[model samples]
Target: MFILDIFSLQQNIDFSLRSLTISLLLGTLLSLALKIHYQRFGMSLSNRVAFSKVFVFITLTTTLIISIVKSSIALSLGLVGALSIVRFRTPIKEPEELAYLFMCIAVGLGLGANQWLATIVATTIILIVTIRWKRSEDQSLFLSLDWEKSHNIDLDQLQNCLLKFICDCDLRRFDSRDEREEVIYYINIANSDNLLSLIQKLKTDFPQIGISFLDKTTIPGV
Candidate 1:
């Protein structure tokens, strides 16, 4: 009888573990869905990936903690302590990133509560709507031009040249030191090929000018 009881307990434990695993898997799927939907917008690719990975781990761990353990007081205290000490050092400049993080956490919680179907259905609808919204807008382009301090180029003339090539141009930032200025331009162009051709012309016209092109993937410091 004792052996039979032990076998029954083992089966119950296995069933519970299987349920938890399914929950975590559903959560991960929901997170991925959110990522795909957000990517259609002007979201930073690398930042999105990093946020997704972090949230997935966080949700999975939280689900495990809340499921297997059945102590409300301990859970409440742990949550308080966790929130009190948590700090994010890396600066998240975009507000959209924070929204995505919250969505990921919500899906995880939903799955942990054994609401896998709801999580999947809700995420799917959200992704569809986001993709539709992205289709309505044009993609944005960024161009950065860096030159040596010693170069004596006419900034006004350069700006004129860029204005002719792009639909709109703005001086986004300038890093100046020792009489040197690294000017960054945020341009809205109808086509990327036009921007490339413009850069080539600039290179040909001023071979001595230290000009560079950058995209969304380029980091500010690097």
Candidate 2:
């Protein structure tokens, strides 16, 4: 009697040149489109060019992960465990940024699964809706920050924080003495809730500092 094994352990990994190439190409193009859409229509207080990389990186990594895991159930489980252990401590200041990141991940998931057509179509629809929505609601808001500096003050960090929560922040004034300095910033933002929230968050983060926003139009001195 000849004994034959019907179920064998196959460890070999195979890549289809055509499918891999098409998926990656689609992912790259879709990510680029998302980056552009975000830069042009993003309503966040900070729209730094450096942030665009988040979309590109997330999309490509997702694509790679999905592609690699598709061939092995073992690898897919490993990915889940690895991701579960990782935690991000940094706060996401803008909801829109988080939404975009999620969209990028979705694109990556589709492409990695070799669903190129659906990824492309979905991306297009999302971009159109986001742009039009932003256009429909157009208003300008601004914030002003003034503080008498202390020895513990971090000038660069303060500026960066302002940029992160406001559309544009300019250093209108700065006066320094032996042990202290006075600083002023004029910020452009569009949401009253966000403005109040930012002020409260800043107060909580830096209790020693003075932070407030005033009505620019009512202020007499320019």
Candidate 3:
């Protein structure tokens, strides 16, 4: 009886199989593209692979959910309930990760809705633009630093050391709490190798400092 019902339902939905197949393919491709984009832009290395998995899973799940839930009220209430129960305790440290997550979700939704051509076209354009932006010299690198015994450091000397390696640098944020100062720098370098050298110098000069680096490919979350 159940198998017969399943067959009947499958026959009734005209594009069910097509939508599912396309959604899966698009979700996989889009997730890969977004991951490549994030890496190219030098996003934070920590939890990146895990985050990509989450992004892809969310995209796939949301796509199927949107496709199956037809009634507006049911969809709205179900979404609310589903979201309410979801507690993401892991705070996303980078804003760009949030953006990529959303983009993946959008691509999934588009594919689920049978907007295949649009999804492909839009994603290609975005990928191209991101690649070009990454190659440009105007992009800034984000640096996270934790200075131990903050009083031991001289801001002028640190700035001079950084300036020697980069063409332009700016302090984006500084937080001093619990005997540690967290400093973030936006630096424009002539090349990616130069950026790595600057980070190495920071470690060599101040062995006690904890340093992390990311680039412009970050996305913001709501």
lDDT of 1 by residue, 116-188 (tens): 7887788778767766775554435566666667887777888888887778888888787886667788766
* lDDT of each residue in 1-222, candidate 2, tens digit only: 123221221334455768877888888999999998877677654554568778888998899888888887767788999999999997776677789889999999999999888888988998998788886653344344444555367879877766666677778777676755667777666554456567777787666776555545446664
Estimate, for each residue in 1-222, the C-alpha lDDT of model 3 and write its tens digit.
999977776556444666687778887877777776665564354566666767677778767876665324445576889888988897767776877877888887787777789988998898888767766745467878887665578877888999988889899898888888888888877655576688789888988888887756653530
TM-score (C-alpha, index-matched) for candidate 3: 0.59
- What TM-scores do the predictions have? 0.56, 0.60, 0.59
lDDT of 3: 0.74
Per-model lDDT: 0.67, 0.74, 0.74
The regions of model 1 sitting more than 4 angstroms off are 1-15, 36-42, 45-48, 68-74, 138-186, 189-222
Off by more than 4 A, model 3: 1-15, 42-50, 70-77, 137-165, 168-187, 190-194, 197-222
Q: Is candidate 1 or candidate 2 better by TM-score?
A: 2
Higher-lDDT candidate of 2 and 3: 3
Q: Model 1 misses residue 9 by how many Å?
A: 18
Clashes of each: 0, 2, 4
